[model samples]
Target chain A: GQQVMQIPQYQHVQEGEDFTTYCNSSTTLSNIQWYKQRPGGHPVFLIQLVKSGEVKKQKRLTFQFGEAKKNSSLHITATQTTDVGTYFCAGYTGKLIFGQGTTLQVKP
Target chain B: EAGVTQSPTHLIKTRGQQVTLRCSPISGHTSVYWYQQALGLGLQFLLWYDEGEERNRGNFPPRFSGRQFPNYSSELNVNALELEDSALYLCASSDGTSDVKNIQYFGAGTRLSVL
Candidate 1:
């Protein structure tokens, strides 16, 4: 059985500050997927990292996969109030195993 | 294209009762997955259906079961429910043909309340 663990279960940051969440897997992952879930909304796919030491960016958000492929991270720069949500990292092997998720709250 | 769709946005049932949740995958998707999200808990894998066959399941009781339709749609059935079964059930679909690299799209999910 594989387990994905996320750090900083909850975070409250002032707007314009940077926020980062880390995810680690107990087993080697074939790929890692990131998702965002707004309050009371379903999870939405954000990005997928497959190659080791891969780094991808979307707007102000940056995602990175560790060289071991067992860890991943999502960083948000200059967070806004609209950036409030829970970020989840899921490791994929035979199936997807989601982490506990990190809840981010940005203050105005 | 339309995303995954689920039915009965919310459901209320009692312990010892049975409940069924439905999901319609995006057009052309061939794999469906079910997950349970309890309050303050991570998503727990429930079942995975591909090509109308049960491909994988998590460490849940037999009371939690489901089936996949030929049309690629899926239904989750929970029997002999308990108060702990109160949680949100989410359904996701992906292109099964890809095998290793499937990015799942999820539905809004069905909130189940068991009293």
Candidate 2:
């Protein structure tokens, strides 16, 4: 069985602070995807990284995939009140396996 | 184009009962996936259906089963449900093509409560 673990299950940061969540997989992944879910909402696809040691950015959010393809991280710069949500990293081997997710709370 | 659509936005059942949740993927999407999300928890993979066939399943009991229709729509059935079965059931769909990267689009999900 393959497993994906995420760190800092819960994070609370001030409005102007930066936040980062790490994800590690028990086995190498074919690809990794990031998602965000608002309170009482379903998960929404964000981005996918297929190349090793790849980094992608969307506005103030940065996503990086490890060179070994077993780890990934998502960093949000200068968090805003609208950024409050649960961030999840999913790894794909034969099928998709989701991490427990990191809930981010941005204080205004 | 519409996103994935799930039925009966909410359901309430008691222990030992059976429940069925339905999902219609976005047109032209051939893969449907089921996941369970408990209160304050992450998404747990349940089942995957493609081309009206059972493709892959998670570590769930036989009590959890499902099927895909010719239209690529799917139904998830849970029999002999227990209190622990209460959770939000999310249905997602992806284009099962070689060129596509298998990015899943999710439905609003069906909230199930078993007493």
Candidate 3:
């Protein structure tokens, strides 16, 4: 069985602070995906990484996949109120095992 | 194009009762997935249906079951519901292909409250 774990179950940051969440797996993953869910909203797809040591960026957010493919990370820069949500990392088999999610609260 | 759509949006039921949640996938999608998110918890995989067949399921009890329609739509049935069954159940759809890297588009989710 594959399981994904994430750190910093909860975080609060100033408007301009940087935030990062890490995802680790009990077994190697073929790929890893990230998602965000606002309070009272459904989870939405973010970005994904498949290749070892792969890195991708979306404006202020950066995502990376570990060389071993057993870990990943999501980084946000200059956080804003809109960034207030729970960030989840899902490790997949034929199906995905979602992390417990990291709740981010931003203070302006 | 429409995203995944789920019915009722909210459901309220009492213990020992039964409830069914519906999900309609985006057009042309062939795979449907069900997940339950307890308050302040992660999305726990419930089941995965593709091409009108049950391909896989999570570590849930037999009381939780579902089926996929010929059109790839799905219905999740929960029997003998208990207070612990209270959670936001989300439905997602994907092409079930590697091209999308198994990316899943989720619906607004049906918030189920078991009294």
Candidate 4:
């Protein structure tokens, strides 16, 4: 069975501070996807990584995939109150396996 | 294009009762996945359906079952519900093609409360 583990189940940061969440998988993954869920809202797709040691940036957010394809990380620069939500990392083996998720709380 | 849609935004049931949750995937998508999210918890995989066939399922009992229609709509049925069954059931759909890396789009989800 494949499993994805996420660290820092909860995080609270002041505005303008940086935040990062790490994800690791029990088995090598073909691809990894990141999603964000706002309070009382559904999970929304953010980005995906396929190649090993790949790094992609979306505005102030940066995503990185490990060289082994078994780990990933999401970093937010200059946090804002609008950044408060739960972030999830899902790995694709034969099927998609979701990490426990890291909930972020940004203080104004 | 429309995103995944789920029916019965909220449902209330008692223990031992059976409940059915419905989902309609985005047009042209062939895969649908179901997950349970408890309060302040992560998404727990339940079932996956593609091309009107059962593709995969998570570590859940037989009481959790579902089917996909020819049109790609899906239904998840939970029988003999327990208090722990109270959670938000989310429905997500993917293109079911390898090229897209199976990127999924999720619906708002149906909240079920078991008494």
Tell me which of candidates 3 and 4 scores higher on lDDT: 4
Segments of candidate 4 deviating more than 4 angstroms: B97-99
| Per-candidate RMSD, Å | 1.3, 1.2, 1.2, 0.9
Residues B4-111, model 3: lDDT tens digits? 999989999999999999999999999999999999898889999999999999999999999999999999999999999999999999876563348899999999
Could you list the chain B TM-scores for each candidate?
Answer: 0.96, 0.96, 0.96, 0.97
Error of 4 at A79 (Å): 0.2
- Candidate 4: true contacts recovered, fraction: 0.66
lDDT digits (tens) for residues A42-101 of candidate 2:
999999999899999999999999999999999999999999999999988877889999
Which residue runs of candidate 2 sit more than 4 Å off their true CA positions? B97-100
A1-108: candidate 3 lDDT, tens digit per residue:
678999989999999999999999998887899999999899999987888899999999999999998999999999989999999999876567799999999999
lDDT of 2 at A84: 94
Best by TM-score: 4
Is 1 or 2 the stronger prediction by DockQ?
1
Candidate 1 lDDT, tens digit per residue, B1-115? 9999998899999999999999999999999999999976778889999999999998899999999999999999999999999999999999863526589999999999999
Distance (Å) between predicted and true CA of A39, model 2? 0.5
**Residue-wise C-alpha lDDT for candidate 1, range A13-104, written one tens digit per residue:** 99999999999999988899999999888899999999999999999999999999999999999999988999999989877888999999
- Cα error, residue B61 of model 4, in Å, equals 1.4
Per-candidate Cα lDDT values, in order, are 0.93, 0.94, 0.92, 0.95
lDDT of 4 by residue, B1-115 (tens): 8889999999999999999999999999999999999999999999999999998888899999999999999999999999999999999999975834599999999999999
Error of 1 at A38 (Å): 0.2
Give one digit per residue, the lDDT tens place, for model 4 in A1-108.
Answer: 788999999999999999999999999999999999999999999999999999999999999999999999999999999999999999998788899999999989
TM-score of chain A for candidate 1? 0.99
CAPRI grade, predicted model 2:
medium
Instruction: Provide i-RMS per model in Å.
Output: 2.0, 2.1, 1.8, 1.5
**Best prediction by DockQ:** 4
Give per-residue CA lDDT, model 2, range B1-115, as digits (tens).
8999999899999999999999999999999999999999989999999898888888899999999999999999999999999999999999963423688899999999999
